[model samples]
Target: MKFLIFILGPSLLAIAVPLYNRIEPRLAGFPVFYWYLLLLIPFGSLCLYLYDRGRSDDRRPE
Candidate 1:
């Protein structure tokens, strides 16, 4: 369902990043842990923004 997707999507991304680091040690200029850790802030914010936007868009005019 949409609700499940919205909640789980970000969590999956969070988990995958670390898994990716384990598979590929270097990303850009940093180690996988550092890269994933740095990405957490922006990725989390983006997920929250998308969740809010989806909720707003789902509203129907009354």
Candidate 2:
């Protein structure tokens, strides 16, 4: 359902953070752990924004 998108964003982070909990790979001297978390901010926001956008039409008055 539409609600899945709302749940998916944070759920992905919850699952991904631990799975990706490593310091091997680096980006611009930042460890994978640090950069990946930084990257997720926008990704998570986009997911939630998409979810809200998907629901906006439903709430609009005719």
Candidate 3:
């Protein structure tokens, strides 16, 4: 369960950005979809990084 959640969390965000881009209308002369897609790149990276870090922290120290 933990592994699934860890993997799915970033995967969903990756999918959501493109999906949002396809669905959202343009705003302020910039596509909201593009904005979200761009934003999600770093955000997803951060999420993946944090998940991995947390998993590593859970290990019993040798």
Candidate 4:
């Protein structure tokens, strides 16, 4: 379960690149593909953050 959450960050990349591999739409003068990859930084961090938070909870006394 927790392992799956950790995988979400990379899994998103594996699943998303092909879907966003285009330049038709632009953001702040940047191609959608470029900005989308940049945007993933925080999103992927959030996924990893969530995974780490969940893992910490598992280590607490219960």
Candidate 5:
């Protein structure tokens, strides 16, 4: 699960650069590259929250 976090967050963002490095199909008159980066903000936050939640669970006395 921890490994999945890295793959989803950073890896996904990295993948987007090449995949969305285009100018067609713009959103709100913004290029795909720009919109992708904007959307990544929330996606990255969710990933970080998931990671932090998992990490906290690990530290709890069991």
Candidate 6:
């Protein structure tokens, strides 16, 4: 479950360049690549947060 969260960013980013390299779709006049990267910001943050949450739970107290 947690492992899936960690891979979210990598998986999406792996295809992001090819997927959003075009300029066919525009959002608010912004290019698809621009908005696509903007959208990934929050998504990547969420993935990192989830991974950190899961990693912290595995810590061993000294």
Q: By lDDT, is 1 or 6 better?
A: 6
Q: Rank the candidates by TM-score, best first.
A: 2, 4, 5, 6, 3, 1
lDDT of 6 by residue, 1-62 (tens): 66765766557684768888978689999898888888887788788887878778778886
Question: How badly does each model clash, as a count of residue pairs?
Answer: 0, 0, 1, 0, 0, 0
TM-scores, each model vs. reference: 0.55, 0.72, 0.59, 0.71, 0.68, 0.68
| Top model number, TM-score | 2
Report, for every candidate in turn, its global Cα lDDT versus the true structure.
0.72, 0.77, 0.71, 0.77, 0.76, 0.77
Model 5, 9-60: lDDT tens digits are 5666757677889988899999988888888777777777778777886696
In model 6, the number of clashes is: 0
* True-structure RMSD for candidate 6: 2.6
User: All predictions: root-mean-square deviation over Cα?
Assistant: 3.6, 2.5, 3.3, 3.2, 3.1, 2.6
lDDT of 1 by residue, 4-52 (tens): 6667776787777546565357777687777776877687777777787
Task: Give per-residue lDDT, candidate 6, residue 27.
Answer: 92
Native-vs-model 2 lDDT? 0.77
Q: What overall lDDT, based on C-alpha atoms, would model 3 receive against the true structure?
A: 0.71
Across residues 1-62, which tens digit of lDDT does each residue of candidate 3 receive? Answer: 76666668667866764467563476565677777677777877777787779888778887
Residue-level error in angstroms, candidate 2, position 24:
2.1
Deviating ranges (above 4 Å) for candidate 2: 60-62
Candidate 1, poorest ten consecutive residues by summed lDDT: 17-26
Per-residue alpha-carbon lDDT of candidate 4 for residues 1-62, written as tens digits (9 for 90 to 100): 66775666567684776888899789999997888888877777888888878778669776
